[model samples]
Target: MHGRCISCRFFANDPALIEATFPGLNVLSSAYGSVRSDAGICSRHEFFLSSWQRCRDFESGDNEGKDALLPVEKKLIGYSIGFGAVLLGILVWISYTFFPTGH
Candidate 1:
């Protein structure tokens, strides 16, 4: 099992570097279902190992995954910004129309 997992040799604490090395690669959990066992490799692990063809040093703890921003949070922020911009534009237009300009 160790031999099988040891085929790949790339591991790093930085996720951006890892991604730059392996493009179009999904995380262990996303590619593989759930990691239930402690011994065997899960889908995500398998995918990572297979795709990158490298094994990380378990002792070093350098293979920390990246912390991704949640999709919901991004969507909410976008909506809020868009809504605020529209509201501000409307308010400005209304004020300009209602208020008389001094000649």
Candidate 2:
């Protein structure tokens, strides 16, 4: 058993990972920010838990795996933002052309 959920294999608190796993969590709510400080999902238990919570079935994950996945997640986020920006620009242009305000 792990002393805390943060160190457990099932706990996923990394900001990039969280954002990648649940699209729009960062925009809709503070998943990694202080508003949910160190809280993450416990996949084994199927619960949203704080870092300090203890788990009886805790298993140490290969921390290196977590680190390795970070770069990929970050890239995904970057691409998503870039795509969103392009889409938004297109929508704005369409709106302005179709329903231009008197100026």
Candidate 3:
């Protein structure tokens, strides 16, 4: 398997974006070429695959009909935000326990 199966999750359905990101790969004619098909790997496992390979049990497009790729910056931002929230919550709890409002 050249890892170009249509059912593969790494398959790029968005020709324009995929071509731009992977200039070396043929986004239009290769078996792994973008079909604009909905099929793809599950969301949970999508991040684990190499951009060059396709998943075996790919399902048709996402419900939003968009490629499931998430920008690295966006992911990082989300992580940072979540971490900050957790830290803040911990600090609030520590302060509440050590310094009661009545005292």
TM of each candidate vs. truth: 0.33, 0.49, 0.30
Q: Return the top candidate by lDDT.
A: 2
User: What C-alpha lDDT, on a 0 to 100 scale, does residue 41 get in candidate 3?
Assistant: 31
lDDT, candidate 3, 1-103, per-residue tens: 3343343433444445544455665644542444534333335353423344555555543333335557987899899999999999998888889888844
Tens-digit per-residue lDDT, 1-103, candidate 1: 2323323233222344444545574553322333322123323343433323334343333333435768998899999999999999998888788874831
lDDT of model 1 at residue 101? Answer: 86
Residue-pair clashes, model 1: 7
Candidate 2: how many backbone clashes?
A: 0
Worst 10 residues of 2 by lDDT: 60-69
TM-score of 3: 0.30
Clashing pairs in 2: none
Clashing pairs in 1: 8-53, 8-54, 8-55, 9-54, 9-55, 28-44, 32-43
Q: Is candidate 2 or candidate 3 better by TM-score?
A: 2
Per-residue lDDT, model 2, residue 43, is 91
Model 3 misses residue 37 by how many Å? 41
lDDT of 3 at 76: 93
Model 3 lDDT, residue 38, Cα:
32
